[model samples]
Target: MESITEEQLIQMVRDFIESESSAPQISVSSSESHIDSDHHHQPSNIDTLEEMIWRETTDVEVEILEKILMYMRNMGSLIIEPKNLKKWVVLRLKMDGYEASLCKTTWVSFPGRAKGNYEFVDVITNGTRVIIDMEFRSQFELARPTQSYTKLIEALPSFFIGTEEKLGNVVTLLCSAAKESLKESGLHIPPWRKATYMLPKWFSENCKKVSFSPNSNSTIEEF
Candidate 1:
């Protein structure tokens, strides 16, 4: 008898599944199907959460992903915790004339009993509790997982409706790499991408300029 290789084992599993319409009875899902008295006896927050959001992936990364919150620090506009958005910024270079997508995610958390998970992201973009809604659309662009960036125009939404009244105007900035970056050895961002700043905050006195680490409390994620 010959031993099966990794590829062969995978193929065998695929063939077995195709031969059988149903999967092995590992555990019943409380999500993808109707609840039965027998299988519904399980306990899991994420299980019920899946039904609440209607999606399998509602995860938000913290160690690095938490940086998305910094955008709120320098904004001059407001959305009053009821909106969500994600935008595409840059693209990774591809032969098909492709680029990685970039964007940000924001929302405020609602006051809830279960870990207070949902409310934080909602107040940020007005999403209901347990949901992580984003305001800037640029974070979703790149499927790659890198960590470095500098100099770009980003949006600043209001926490409360009509925040621009006190915030003045949103603005962009001329930038160097993140504070701990090595680009000083001659940083090379695209000519079209480098910028000084955008207004109405550009004309403000309090908005000071400073170099930040690529990962320094920014809206961009690991990739």
Candidate 2:
């Protein structure tokens, strides 16, 4: 079996997404899809071949893929592997027309009864203070992740919305302002991709300029 290169994998995804059919059939290398020997679990029922390709993959993984493509056309690739029965995907970003692995992004699931399971910083990009918080649960979720982020904003004076207008609660302040915290933060990100994509991209691009750093209380998970 010829080893599949990172470039080939990236082109596969691009081709899959661009295909005219709603669902396209693409062959994946067994090594790429192979699970660990210790792993013992039934594969979840998949509605599409795309989902089967990344069976253990999550919606978040697809989001990260889309964001990487945003910066470059066919230069990025993703490799999905299992870690302790959980699927982890490593992103290879395009550098000088080639793909290079950054680091393995982990997936942390929580018990439903556990408090604050869904609310925390998911992962941080290597060699940068670009923190991607795993909040964005509905504005009505019981956890209220946005409220948690308010502490980050209050702790650092340098943090501000990505738009030109001043920031505040939309209900009480500047309802008519052209710019808004939610809009600027990409909260209303199109249904086509992850809501958190724009935020990370913004932080990655402005980490140095804004001097953005989360406080000690911020729940940052490092793998």
Candidate 3:
């Protein structure tokens, strides 16, 4: 398979932005056919989410996304476990002169939430911080989805590289949509899927930052 070039990945982002701006038409009949009448009466949350995700890309975000795309394309030959991939990506970014780290966040069980931990990569460029999730799209997928919810999922990028503010907005939109989709299907929404729980996965104050030195074989520091 031919590897996707950085230019190609950047073009894909541009195309996605343009497509979102134009609001591509989605086919609803097939997926909505089995939905309940109450679902049909609900407001269009997916449409609102689609509009929310479409915004002008910052220079920093584009640069980071492009670099991540290149790194991912080159990683195809390596074992692609999430832990190793995240560490590798962080190392690569650091070698390229960017401040990158692996962030692990853990929280205890609290009211309306459960105890859990999550890990992801983040980079700081020119004093701006951006969250990078290699498995972004998969996080929002549902077993059974209404047509509108499916459309919203389709619009999400496979990987997410953006600021905390943008990520917060995305979590809010997707979680709300997910709740509505589950309600429509007569299923319970998993606690982890809720925005309140999901947001802390990245935004927690208790997060530990781990950094790797580019010149060392096993030099890792945590703070």
Candidate 4:
């Protein structure tokens, strides 16, 4: 697996947004909510579990969710996605507190071709159920951020049914852990096509993380 520092990942996201600012090729629309009791996955052991995948959302993904909590206090809403194909975040969007990096489901398999099985997955969040769209990836696939997000949003809803509880209700970027695997296997990943323009100075090289403005000075979270 190729090792990538967090900075490289953030640049990929900035580059993605810039590309979309130049032109719009997105064929996206709001998805319908398929909330059915039969479709929802409620676990029998949920009451017994102490540490849950849902709580991991805030702890694992961003380093300073606590500080982000303070910042969100004033704001009524937020929009976030993992950078560089990494994590998924689910927050209460309430009481000025947030939680992310929630895990919905995980699947393990082979790497790519002959397509025998080369696929392992941990679907932390399904955006459709949550009613949002976001994708995270690294600089290598930096070109088509919008396109990728669009596709994930479209496909996630159908699977909402039949999952264990605590796993459902999320759609975060889960590509980080796999970025190295894909590169090591020499898979030809398409550069995210949506981004066409250069990014702002905040994302210039020699950067560590971007402190989200108007928020408590970047908080070392989601830089």
Off by over 4 Å in 4: 24-96, 106-223
Candidate lDDT scores, in order, read 0.25, 0.29, 0.75, 0.28
- lDDT by residue for model 2 over 75-103, one digit each (tens)? 23532321210111222222222222222
Please give the distance, in angstroms, between residue 79's alpha carbon in candidate 1 and its true position after superposition.
8.4
Scanning candidate 3 in windows of ten residues, the lowest lDDT window is 74-83
TM-score of each: 0.18, 0.19, 0.74, 0.23
The clash count of every prediction, one per candidate, is 50, 0, 0, 29
- Evaluate model 3: give its TM-score: 0.74
lDDT score, residue 215, model 2?
A: 28
Residue 183 shift from truth in candidate 4, angstroms:
27
Which parts of model 2 have CA positions greater than 4 angstroms off? Answer: 1-13, 19-21, 24-51, 54-57, 74-223
Worst 10 residues of 2 by lDDT: 159-168
Report the CA-based lDDT of candidate 3 relative to the real structure: 0.75
**What is candidate 4's lDDT per residue for 26-45, written digit by digit as tens?**
23244424456667634222
lDDT of candidate model 1 versus the reference:
0.25
lDDT of 4: 0.28
When sorted by lDDT, best at the front, the candidate numbers are 3, 2, 4, 1
- The positional error of residue 125 in candidate 3, measured at the CA in angstroms, is 1.3
